[model samples]
Target: MEFYLKENGVRTQLEYGELDISGNEDYGYRPFQLMIASIAGCSASVFRKILTKKKIEIEDLHITAEAERDAEHANKITKISLHFIVKGENLDKGKLEKSLELAKKNCTMVQSVKGSIEVVETLELINLSN
Candidate 1:
């Protein structure tokens, strides 16, 4: 795989496996998708780590994310939201919120989008697995 980026540019071009993929694609996930994924992935990892550290037993975890794109020219993402649903035992809502806060604070990707994007998050607890 070869990746190229123009000097002082935000966009990058990537080539891999007989495919030409740019920062944004026509059919596959766009650049914004990758950005959101990084945020969600970072937060999810922090959440899991915090839960494990607190000795909270987790049976499953999932995150659903959505973003609103600007309709005008130079289309870009304006807002993003993520719903974090965790199935675990003896979960504490306060702790979960705190963990999320710390996740956003520590996540380089989340901080990278600061002021450029708006992010909202929700936490949900699910019944323990059978």
Candidate 2:
């Protein structure tokens, strides 16, 4: 992808649309935010696929990510925590937990940053039957 230098940041045009990246949030998305998003999005997608393959139906799935950055070292991301809120009927907690483990193992983005960034995943299940 080619990025053109803008006033404050850089802009890239893609098939879907244009992407603006900047250090300043006022101009565009921050680099760290995008990194966290990539990790979380990849994990969630892989987890959902694993569940589907196991015939687990879900009403909804949401993921929240928190990143810990070190101020002393160029504000680099040191760790990321991902919390998953899963809403479904008759959801097996054990199976979901296993699926999450498998997702962590298989997610490309998670694997990419394995040695550099610590990734932690947690799950909260909401049973529709309740």
Candidate 3:
């Protein structure tokens, strides 16, 4: 919430890190990018907590986010799709799906924009324990 107008440009740093909002996409972090990052980061944490609490041992977890913007409506994000790749041992598809659902509900960023943006989540569980 707090910003510092440094020599380069305006920047904000908090729980995540320092972000430059100089309006130069190449040199600074765009507001839209930060929004998506918040969603992805919150979802990842919540999802991990849900799965771990269920006794699932995770080897790796990766989240990919893609968004569609409405060009006719001031380039606002219309839809966002999240793809999760979870590598783990004895992973149950049903449990993973349920965990993802819980994560989407509990994630603050996702909850904040749930009514405005269409969010889709897909979980790809890779079971290494065979």
Candidate 4:
């Protein structure tokens, strides 16, 4: 589980695998993608963990992520939005909302972003077999 990164004008990677992330200027995920993936992945993990504890069975989970960048000398991410779609059986809105709230409270990834990150979550119960 190791990756080698080099800063050659643009970041580059030397190795990657299922257990590790490797990248290069042309083959690696952009720094921005890493940031976005962190938030999205962490939120989903937290949401699922909390909900599962409350007996909420998730059939599907999807997240839509968007970010706005500053248009100045140091153009960086200014705001990020995460739209969550949760599908399950007998999903409880209160529990679903609570899971999201708890995720927001405990997700280190979201906390690390250090800016205004808005999350919009929707819960839908679907029959996956159908």
Best by TM-score: 2
Model 1: residues with Cα > 4 Å off, grouped in runs: 1-28
Report lDDT (Cα) of residue 67, candidate 2: 93
lDDT winner among the candidates? 2
Quote model 4's TM-score. Answer: 0.72
Q: Go through the candidates in order and give the clash count of each.
A: 0, 0, 0, 4
The digit string of per-residue lDDT tens for model 1 on 1-130 reads 4544533324434553333334546534456777789889988887778777877777888999999889894778888898999787777778878887877787777788899889888989875643
lDDT (10s digit) by residue, model 2, range 34-119: 99999999999999899989999999999989999999999999999999999999999999999999999999999999999999
Point out where model 3 deviates above 4 Å: 5-9, 15-17
User: Can you write out model 3's per-residue Cα lDDT over 1-130, one digit (the tens) per residue?
Assistant: 9998866568888798777876568768777787888888999999998887988788999999999999999899988899999998888889889899999999998999988988899999889987
lDDT of 1 at 75: 75
Using alpha carbons, what is the TM-score of model 1? 0.76
Spell out the clash pairs found in candidate 4. 12-24, 12-25, 13-23, 13-24
The alpha-carbon lDDT assigned to residue 99 of candidate 4 equals: 79
Candidate 1 at 58: error in angstroms?
1.4
CA lDDT of every candidate: 0.76, 0.96, 0.88, 0.69
CA RMSD of all predictions? 4.9, 0.7, 1.8, 4.3
Candidate 4 stretches greater than 4 Å from native: 1-25, 115-130
lDDT (tens digit, per residue) of candidate 4 on 1-130: 3344445323333465232223443644567677788888998898888877877788888888887788793657776688787766666667777778888878898877556545444445453544
